[model samples]
Target: MVAPPDNDVLWARGLHHAHGGTSALAGVSVGVREGEILAVTGPRGSGKTTLLKCLSGQLVPSEGEVWFNSAPVHTLSSPSRERLRLDRFGWIDTEPHLVPELTAWENAALPLLLRGTGTRSAKHTAVEWLDRLDVGMCANRRPARLDQSQRQRIAIARALATTPQVLFADEPTAPLHRSDGTQVLRTLTTAARSHQITVVLATHDPEVATLADRSLALLDGRQSGAAAEAAGSSDEESRAACSLSV
Candidate 1:
């Protein structure tokens, strides 16, 4: 097997995956440089999430290769992949999934704690991320007490507290109001840049994709430049109509 490029922190080639006989990804290949923010754009069902999952080692593609830091991720044993994720990768889901029983700070600190970090250090790091994400004031509250945006922010803090080398964010702002989403995304991107973190962000929103340094668009589980352009035009027309509505 050929090694990935020296400069790419994450790389994949000829990826193919299917779900219950339906293709989710088809011959998808990508590379992400260290500390670069790459936005994966497409309408729903365009394989953005599947690609992220494969790259992040959450799911092995049925066919193809995935590499991280010159190592072949697709060939690693399941336990090794799990350990790699726990140690070096972070993920933010479309919705907040904080533990209802834990305080926000505790929830944020869970990853470090699970990794055997000292309790004090874990709390300190978690609180720092919470403050950065604008959720420090909610640090002591349980998930049930926090609003959706606050909970989501806490979840982001949790992901950031570990300071993983790579962060996968799949439509992270989908659950928030546009105003809330803007602030959260600004904070997320700013923190990632400042920390020199590699980010693979998947989003359907053109505005969101614009924040990344680069973008890769997909359609029907395959990369398509023309389809992406057409989709962008359609989205712009829809936005114009929305602006004209009462």
Candidate 2:
């Protein structure tokens, strides 16, 4: 396979995947540049999550090539892929998925601690991210003690504390109320911009996609035309709003 473009931090071409003989992605190709926020938008079951999973090395495509920093990700062994994710990628799921036994700070610092960071350093970093997400007051509380919105914020803090090279967020605000989701999403995109972390955000909401630098729309497991027109728009002012909003 040919090497990916030098400017692309993550790139995939002709991707195809199936789940138990059922098609999920069909010849989908995408590229994300460093520090760029790319939203994968579509209806439910439109292959957004599958695409994200493939690009993030969580799933191997049945047919295609995935590259990160010009290195072939599709060819990496399972253990190597796990290592790469631990070292370079952060992920936030739709649910909070916080550790029930640990306090919010401890939960947020889990990744850093797993990476062998000092306890003090991990807590410091986690707390800083908590404060940024307006969930610092909940740092000492366990997941059960926090509200749904608060728990989601802690989850986001956990993802950001590592300052990962790339972050994969799959419907990160799905568990929150509309107002809460909007605020949390704003904070997320803003933090990503400030940290220069490339973000691949999967969402079914068009308004949510607007916060991204570009959007890729999928339909029935294939790329659609709607997003193609808007993908290259790159509204600088719109993206700049993230910095100003938070």
The numbered model that scores best in TM-score is 2
Judging by lDDT against the true structure, name the best candidate: 2
What lDDT, from 0 to 1, does candidate 2 have? 0.91
lDDT of each: 0.88, 0.91
The TM-score that candidate 1 achieves is 0.91
TM-score of each: 0.91, 0.96
Q: Which stretches of candidate 1 lie over 4 Å from their true place?
A: 226-246
Model 1: lDDT of residue 168: 99
Please report, as a residue range, the 10-residue window in candidate 1 with the lowest summed lDDT.
237-246
Cα lDDT of model 1 overall? 0.88
Which pairs in model 1 have colliding backbones? none
Please write out the lDDT profile of model 2 over residues 79-175, one tens digit for every residue: 9999999999999999989999999999999999999999999999999999999999989999998999999999999999999999999999988
What is the alpha-carbon RMSD of candidate 2 to the true structure? 1.6
User: Each model's RMSD to truth, in Å?
Assistant: 6.4, 1.6
